[model samples]
Target: MYSLKLVTFVVLSSIPYFCYGAKREDFDLQKMFEDMGEEGNKMRDECFTENEMSLADLHDYDKAEDIPEKELCFYKCFFQKSYVVDKDGKVIIESIKAIEEVKDLEESDRETFTNCLKEIKPVLECKDMVEFEKCFDQILM
Candidate 1:
């Protein structure tokens, strides 16, 4: 009976893990942005500025007729590293180690300014200033 109870407890605990790993087919960026409201726009703007690319420029790049394969691959890799998708299709923040490389900033030179790192938690870690803004908006919303 004790062995059976132990097995049951283990199975019960694992159930949450399995359920959490289930793929979410309805992940909506629009809804998330809407949820963020003004804060989302601010974050997006900050991200664009930090990346040195305007929203129009990014849109144009995405809509480019002939984007280089290597560039596309690089973007994919970058997104994957930032987003932290798991084998089970669940997304989580993996690491924010890149934040440590920042140099020569005034008040914003700390580990993470604007609480972006704390906001993303363990699913979408932000490594840099640009990513921090993006993740901050996403988490805030």
Candidate 2:
């Protein structure tokens, strides 16, 4: 059985990504959650190894205020593999367009939006995934 802690992380971690991402086939997210058993753990372990990251540095969900670089990469890689996040760590523009409130943004704001997304690219462009997320948060604000 998956630990309660891991389960909580799955839910919490999935929300922001899903809320911001374009819709996919039905049960894709659900399958990702369900598959996080043996194969998932192994994949995560391999990702940590490949990324020169250590599982020891990973923080629990409650302490996830600022993820460490390597740990963040692990999550990023895993989510990308799961198709929950794009390879570039962006909120797909299609997803943004599908939202009801997004229709109301002024055209000028769209430039700001596009620029902000471009700025976020540099974050993902680097090797440090935590910084990528941080840069996204900063530029996206």
Best by TM-score: 2
Q: Tens digits of per-residue lDDT for model 1 on 30-61?
A: 12222323433454445445555443332112
Ten-residue stretch with the least lDDT total in model 1: 58-67
Regions of model 2 farther than 4 Å from truth: 1-35, 60-65, 92-141
- For candidate 2, which ten residues in a row score worst on lDDT? 132-141
**What's the true lDDT of residue 73 in model 2?**
67
Q: Which pairs clash inside model 2?
A: none
Give residue 50's error in model 2 in angstroms: 1.5
Error of 2 at 54 (Å): 3.4
TM-score of each: 0.23, 0.40
lDDT of 2 by residue, 1-141 (tens): 234235334533453343233344325544554455665666666766777865444433322244445656666666455443476576455444333344455666655554554455432532444433332333233
